[model samples]
Target: MFSEERRQEIYTIIREQKKVKVAQLAEKFSVTLETIRSDLKYLEGEGLIKRCHGGAILGKQEIKKISKFSDSFDISCLLHDLLIVRERKDRKPEGKVCVLGSFVVDIIANVDSFPKVGELINSKSNSIGPGGKGTNQAMAASFSDAKVHLITKVGEDHFSKYAYKYLQESGIDSFTIFQTEIEPTGSSISYLADKTQNNITATYLGANNTFSEQEIDISLPYVSEADVLLLQGEINIEANIKAAMFAKSVNKIIVLNVAPYSEDLKQLYATLDFITLNANQASHWADIEINDINDATQAINVISGDENKKVIIYMDELGVVYFDGRATFHIPPMPSLRVDTMAATDAFNGAFASKIAAGGTMHESVLFASAFLSAFIEQKGVTAMPVLSQVQARLKSRLEDIRPQIICNEKRCI
Candidate 1:
């Protein structure tokens, strides 16, 4: 058997038995004592077991004791404490969000700069990991304590297991994730410019484009229960439209993040509760030239069309511009060391949706998301996204530094 398969089995045994001796594992597997010891060490490193002198036990964190002073706490404080307790007891998430998108394995090569056409250059480093806007956003939402359901299609291949393992580890529900036998898993090759932190990418849609009408039917019930349904342009336009229409019929809040720009999605703009995009996407959707905050404000006004649609334009280093029909606020970017810029927008969208689902006001949610993206961009690879605690801490620490600049309608500044 393969080492990974053997290690997985051993992990299961230790989990079911609660504890197991090294000698017993060695005897059961017909392996040498040294091999069993190595397995135990590996499991321990993965935080699946706690090694003792002769055996290993399941690794579980001890629950903290609530303070006796809670009896005198206010009703709101008491309720907050109770919710925390409930989350700890059930190990289930509270905020409900459905992310309808794609999951592509990203192959990234870091280079000092882009090569000219017909030229070749050696990369500084290369890595492969979980990517695709949909998966990244779903995982980001999961990290922020949202009960995320990711509905995406992947091929039935080796790359598919990475998606399964990642979702399992992140505690996001993947039951709605579909698999295609005919097409290979979607993938992207990104060249990261080391000096400028910019990335150029090319993608193959693959199974992402294979989401069928049947899969859409299967996802309706789950999507109906969601507080928010997040859609991106990575998947087929038909699937995105179908999901949006279903969510609208059920009165679920629809948040559309327009990436890879699709002209067909323009028809659904009126139905969207919130629309998030970068400058290029906004320019395309609004049919105007957008280069700065002033240009973005004008473009958003044109696209919003006096409706209640909220528009968020992510302005890279200049921060984000938020228009809630009445007011346009400019939120400054949080301070962070520059790293990979691959997942910044996904982090923002996921964190924003997570905060909104958790009952935060629009302004508060944006602030929280900004903090999350700041922290996320400081790290590299798929693990760049931070947990809720980290985001909250960053928000608290940088509260004064990253305050939003109210451009107009000063009455509603958050």
Candidate 2:
């Protein structure tokens, strides 16, 4: 169809349906999502339609919302979220997530390759910033406009100063940071191997080790207010157990990212609402080598140990495979010129937790988190994670890419 004819049809459809999804329009026209987006862009420019999160609306109210929210924050992202929420009010979760985790200051350097025994390599670039499973996840949740309270311990030192600075600059407006005088804040040295874009990090979790059960008790007030509790393996085991038990008692949605996996956490596996880990971690825990979708599905079931646990495994080139208790869904990896992947998992977990907390079904949150991660791998550092608008811009394209890859029903995955 010609551009003018397609736009007319899209206008008519919007008038009829009130709101039209980009994917549906692209499918109906037998065109690319970007093409439909362009048509919508032209129509929106003509003041005939308003573009929402993943679709277009047929009213001026979206424009009013844009003007109201534009004065603060990134207007495009917040406006997009508002329009979507208004369009689907029932899906809006509590909009709050509480993360129980750790904080770390990273000293990262870029080099040609791993240094040989007793050899020194010239560093290409280096940076110091705040990072940790907990810190990165909290920032990612905040990026999605989820109110996040990161409960972690830091040392009374200059690095602690950087911790607060990094979170503030990264758009985290809330914190439950605690300081310890006994040990300095956690620190790590990461080497980014430039040739392959791989990374190796060695960390000393300083004050984070000092977080006790008492500290977990102190954080209960914040945890009680959240719809989701996001946990990671970076902190002490006792703290994680205590936090998990409390969140379970409160009947909150509990999610765990088993990075740097620990066998000690097996105790909490049966009770978790969602579990995210890479293929290697799943393999180690489930005692299975993940080769394909079938292998991944088996690994998920073994690790989950029961049908009630939802599991997600991140495969390097094959993308993500998720088991929603009974069935498995495999989503193809988003194509990108990946420069650094160090923070991809962190960003994914954070975005995933926020989405799941917002009442997003398993596949919906997986797609959303993967969209956030696709934009994330193109850059370096956790701080370089994309805003909601960038992620939203990719959502339609992602749906297009993911539809063919989603193999449902009795274990058709890969």
**Per-residue alpha-carbon lDDT of model 2 for 285-381, expressed as tens digits?**
8999988877887787677664458889988678898888767778888887888888789989999988888888888899999888888889867
RMSD of 2: 17.7
Candidate 1 residue lDDT tens string, 1-414: 123434656766765788888899888656688988898887666555789989888778311211332222212222231111113233356678999998899999999999999999999999998889998898788777887878877887898767655654555644355777788889999999999999899999789998888778867887988999998999988888888998999898889999888888787786799999998899998888887888888777776665758889999988999887678888889999988788889999998998888888789889999999988988877666676778889999999987777787732332
Best candidate (score: TM-score): 1
- What C-alpha lDDT, on a 0 to 100 scale, does residue 132 get in candidate 2? 84
Give the TM-score comparing model 2 with the true structure, all chains together: 0.75
Each candidate structure's TM-score, on Cα atoms with residue i matched to residue i, is 0.76, 0.75
* Stretches of candidate 2 exceeding 4 Å from the true structure: 1-94, 404-414
* lDDT against true structure, model 2: 0.78
Per-residue lDDT, model 1, residue 179, is: 74
Q: Name the 10 consecutive residues with the lowest summed lDDT in model 2.
A: 81-90
